[model samples]
Target: MLTKQDIVAVVVLYNPNKKVYDNILKYKGLVNRLILVDNSLTNNKYLFKNIDFVDYIPLYNNYGIAYALNLGIKNSTEKYILTMDQDSAISANLINSYLKFLNVNDNNGIGALTCQYNTDRNPAVAKKGYVKVRQSMQSGTLFKRSTFDKIGYFDDKLFIDVVDLEFFLRMKRSELSLVRINAAVLNHHPAETKVKKILFLKLKYGQSSEVRNYYKARNLFWVAKRYNSLDMYKGLTISWLKIILLYDDKRKYLKAFNQGIKDAKHNRLGKYYSNYEGN
Candidate 1:
């Protein structure tokens, strides 16, 4: 039986405002421990001092999400680590349910378990059951610490974006399981406006910024090179085709597409930003 001693929740915060802190407090009693990695330099240390459940580790600069997550993993002292974004909120039974799942399905070779994540609407339904996905969002997922020991931590080289995808692909190739728990609920702040949505998609799969373009293109190529499966290649092709047809900004869209191709050819991917400005 997996007890509370087996789990620890890790949240990485970078210049997170009060809302993020408030969100973390909601899960204070649910987990065995809460680990917070503060990647800010404003000396807001005192602000988090009052939160008894939080163990705040301060980094000098913005080390990006992937690096911070690796730091959190290093700091954690539990058998299982639940990774959550600072802005994420979980259901009351999330921790218990995940612990229960882990204890019973020990032979499944499961590296991570993702909850049904909702963004404004019912995004969870789109991803139901114990479906296997290439990437598991860092927020709303519980991971076995031993998984990291086997696959290693999130790739610090990718930095922020697509680190989840990269890690999950590695897990998949290694024949490890990535399960989605439909019962566990997670609420996320979705892109409400059309512009925000465009920007989100662009940054995720487009090439609006040089940095973003580099990563998107590079990562896609890397995945292709490493896996070289027809299914993976087809998925990539279809995704690019959808971006071209769905988004309105033709010039921006084309630019991103072309950049992705160039990066893929040269194997120069890492991270990229969309043209949309709103955060």
Candidate 2:
């Protein structure tokens, strides 16, 4: 059984609303510490003094999710860190489930244990039970503090898209185990998507702005090239093909793809140029 002092929950915030606060409160009692990394453009410290366990760290600007997560990991004083996004939801038994899973598997070289998250993405996951994976999304993931020493922090250059995947790749190179528990489920709402059947294939894709398309293309190329992993490179290549081909706004996405390839060649990373018109 994991006690309150063993785990710290880090939830990153970006232009959050009252519902965000409400969601945070739901999980506060499950962990030892609750830390909020506020990346809002406005400088507003929202330390919940009433709840001594909660600590707020405001960046006053959008530093991206990777940066915020790295800051949380550094500030956490617990044995393990549980990461979540503002839009993530989890089963009520999330903490205890992870604790139970860790108790037996922690000694077996498990660096990060993430629960099965239902997403529209084409992630390679085992169909059942606890299965080892190369990468999983950040939400509902429990990572050991010591893994940072071996694998380093999340790649801040990634900014948003593929940050978790890049970090997990580093963990793999260091021989750290990345496992997912199929029973411990996480409900995540990723980019809105509708499944469409084209001939014999079922394609899952959604509308994405030029900004997102740019990041996805750039990061997929950058990380795949940097890691020299043919598996990821080939996988992302196919996924990108599907998104670009099946997307409703193919012209804009095609333009974004070209921009991304250009940016990746120039080594332009972090937050790219976006007019902040839409998500």
Give the winner by TM-score. Answer: 2
Report, for all candidates in order, the number of backbone clashes. 9, 0
Error of 2 at 234 (Å): 3.1
Give the Å shift of residue 62 in candidate 1: 2.5
Instruction: State the lDDT of candidate 1 residue by residue for 194-250, as single tens digits.
Output: 332554463332223434433554566556667675544665676466556655665
* Alpha-carbon runs more than 4 Å astray in model 1: 41-43, 125-134, 190-214, 229-235, 269-279
lDDT for model 1, on a 0 to 1 scale?
A: 0.70
- What Cα-based lDDT does every candidate model obtain? 0.70, 0.79
Question: Which 10 consecutive residues of model 1 have the lowest summed lDDT?
Answer: 270-279
TM-scores for the candidates: 0.79, 0.88
Candidate 1, position 124, lDDT: 54
Please list all clashing residue pairs in model 2, or write none if there are none: none
Candidate 2, TM-score vs. the true structure? 0.88
Candidate 1 residue 119 C-alpha distance from true site, Å: 2.0
lDDT of 2: 0.79
